[model samples]
Target: MRIQEFLQHHGIATNPFADEDAQTDLVFKTACIRSVYHPAWDKIYGDPSEPATAVVFGEKGSGKTAIRLQIARHLADHNADHPQQQVFVVPYDDLNPFLDRFRERFSARRRRRPDRVLSQWHLWDHIDAILALAVTQLVDRLLGVRDARHPAARDEPLDCTMLDGSQKRDVLLLAVCYDQSTADNRLKRWQQLRRKLGVSVWMSYWDIAVGVAVTAIVLAAIALLGGWNWLLTVWPYVAIAAGWLPCGWRLLKWTWKAWQIARCTRTLRQTIPFLRRMLMRFPAGQLEGQPLPVRAATDDRYAMLDKLQGVLRTLGFAGIVVLVDRVDEPYLVNGSTDLMRALIWPMLDNKLLKHPGLGVKLLLPSDLERLLDREDRDF
Candidate 1:
């Protein structure tokens, strides 16, 4: 029997078993994402009232990437339905940049096991990268909504009044390191930026107060020395420096630290162009260019993660789902079970996997299943 005749006799509309990539095949992709819903869909997507995280393990051709796309589509639908309680979706499927960064940063390692070194690359890096991705996407979406010049956003209808001007600026600045916007938009947000964002502060009141106190003390000393005439001539310069010196120094320190982060991490480094564009927005160059609130490598990850969750909450995002897939594609991993093991180990951190406001859907390759037994926690 001919193939078409056999297919017609079988009552099949088309070749369902074709040897094409499911992600690219139109019929297969639609079937996976829209037509058919998996049994575990609800569990993985989770309750909207409470954000949750889940891990899905499957081998090649097991529909892992398909599931990721399904979740993203579902969340987008949910957002479209309920704009007031929208969930931001951050798709972090790319791994090449991360792999490149790992290679560059740790060139001369002890060279024990590739997997071991991958594990030692630290969960903090993974967490930091995920947070950065979320912030970048959020900024891009907001800018696209406000400005029509950029690429059209996939955002559902969102209530702009969810965030105040200052809060909006805070979120905008967080993204400025990742995505570019017009100079006018950048300047607007820069001007609206607050001195403090929760525990984080752009410029501290104590620093300014100290400068004022020092200026007063110096002026008093000059008065006691009976050199009021000379003091008058120099007082203006002294006062100006003292008033602005502390603020400028703090900004310089933050800029230097931000530069370090950009240098050390490829994820952060990509944001440099956006940072420069933001800097140019300020004609006086007085705006602080410190975008991410990263401190040291270790502590900053957790701190920034918490801050990012808070920012998302303030932006009226009831949930933020980070979809991670494509584990074996990068040259660093290259389908090696060892490299995949090392890379995915840190991501299994319970704290990150089960964040309150953030939902993580980790679509892991089946090869990672063997390593799961080593650190078998409830997470």
Candidate 2:
């Protein structure tokens, strides 16, 4: 007898256990996602009004991904109902891009060793990756850039009018630092977002204009006061070069700052020149005293996350929910339990998991649960 006939004899409509992965399993996607519920469902999925963090560990084929999909589906339903107090869902399962960039940061010899590469991973790197993903998605919504892969992209686009001037600046700043779309022109997309948000970029070009104006004035002074022959002299050129001192100094400062950010944010695939160029597009006054993710500590990242949450709140998001799943699937980890432990241990910090206005759901492998006993009370 065929499997379908055997399942029918048991009074079952279809086979639910036939598929292993929930992402590609048609049966689970159509039926089980709505009806099936784990015993710990209520505990894992707390009140949507005020999100909470939950960490779950299970062996392979234990429905961890299914639970993640269910949470996403339920959150979508909740968002449709409660439009004002919606939770911003950030699916943080994809780790290959981050791991690839992180490995490039090390030497060839060091990159060969998975332990060494993963050992360098810290909570700040994770935070940077999350911020990059979140900011990129928001930019897509604002610009109406559609990607078939992103389910939420088909939904209503974000209302740009809802954001005020400061919030607009915050969104633009976040995009400059973290938007990582390889398909579109980064500068053009940023300019489009700036226009959509009604942000003024005139101030960003003030320094360059000042340098050019000063150079023009110097050349005109030499021609009018000392005759055209003075323009051919070395003194005129010297004065013209001196006129660019302000622009040159600002460029140097921003370049150094970009290098620091690129070096410190090891997981993000950004170069010094690109980051510097993006930084130059922002007005100096707008970026003054801003918390940039250019340090090794988590303090700056937390502050940036707070800024993001505040912006989201103004845009109708009551809170943020980060769903982290598939810890062992990245190429570097390759299903190795030891490397998975190294990659995930840094994110177990209570402070980050319990951060206000944020909910982090880490779906991990069962193997890592054994190492939890060795951790101290602080973890």
Quote the positional error of residue 254 for candidate 1 in Å. 3.5
Model 2 has a clash total of 0
Q: Which candidate gets the maximum TM-score versus the true structure?
A: 2
Q: Write the per-residue lDDT of candidate 1 for residues 279-312, one digit (tens) a residue.
A: 4333233344434544435455565565566666
lDDT of 1 at 189: 44
Question: TM-scores of the models, in the given order?
Answer: 0.70, 0.94
* Candidate 2 RMSD to the correct structure: 2.0
Candidate 1 residues lying further than 4 Å off, grouped into runs, are 2-5, 8-14, 106-120, 145-161, 176-252, 263-266, 270-298, 376-379
lDDT of 2: 0.86
Error of 2 at 224 (Å): 2.2
lDDT of 2 by residue, 73-128 (tens): 88888888988898888899999999999999999999889999899999998999
In angstroms, give how far residue 198 of model 1 lies from its true place: 20
